[model samples]
Target: MSYQENYIKQLHTLLRLVTDSVEGYKSAAEHVDSTEYKDLFNNISRQRESIAAEFRERISGYGGNAEVESPDLMASLHRSWMGIKTAMTKKDDQAVMESCRNGDQALLDAFDDILQGDLLNNADLKTFIMDQRLKVNEVFLDLDDRYFKLFKKDPSI
Candidate 1:
């Protein structure tokens, strides 16, 4: 593929991942019973939506189609699994939090994959990706801390 094609492809991949994250967060918010958790997930979903918009703009600027025709297969399956798990656990808050944590980790992994690749050589794009990754990592860590606190408070969780 040409340089432009490769660059656009990378942006598309990021866009799809962020889009999946948005849906995943929204789903988590809906499934969880905690008002605080719901608010947190909804806020994160909005943040992810903004990031996805940036990716779309970058793809468009590169003369590539920015529209994601469908959700990634793996992400769709993950969401389905989350729903089933939530149901099985009877909408347990801990289970919902655990699923969200896993989804966030998947997102962070995608960011790491793209950042480690040489194809992302553009300085501006690289910086943008780094900034977004940091934001995601910050939230992931917060979620991790919260999960552990909850787990510690009640081992049964």
Candidate 2:
């Protein structure tokens, strides 16, 4: 596969994870304790869904399968971890803090891979990837700040 082809496959995997993460977050919002956390999860879930739509379209435009070719291993694992943490917290904030850290790490890993890879020759995809990286970084940073404020120890973020 061309680098672009690999990227397309990777992106489809991302979309699949995003879809599952969105669903998980939505469930968290409805079943979680705090209204603030609920709202945050809901908003983030919607944002992820929107990103997934864009990814699907971009993949299809490239003559690739847009319907999520593979599972997002990291995100799926993160979701499971988050659920366990949610159950363990019992209204404490540590679990959510752990979740934030894991999410930050996942986003960072994803964007770092995209950033280090050579995609500049593909103008359209390169631009899109750059934009997504910036967006993902922004979200990660914001979540890190929130987690720091809530947890106040910087566990691993």
In terms of TM-score, which candidate is strongest? 1
- Model 1 poorest ten-residue lDDT run: 116-125
Put down candidate 1 lDDT per residue, 13-119, tens digits, no spaces. Answer: 88888899899999999999999999999999999999899889989999999999788787888899999999999888889899988988988898899888865
Taken over the whole model, the C-alpha lDDT of each candidate is 0.89, 0.70
Backbone Cα, N, C clashes tallied per candidate: 0, 0
Q: Report the C-alpha displacement of residue 42, candidate 2, in angstroms.
A: 0.3
- Counting only residues 3 or more apart in sequence or on different chains, how many pairs clash (N, Cα, C under 3 Å) in candidate 1? 0
Q: How far is candidate 1 from the true structure (C-alpha RMSD, Å)?
A: 1.1
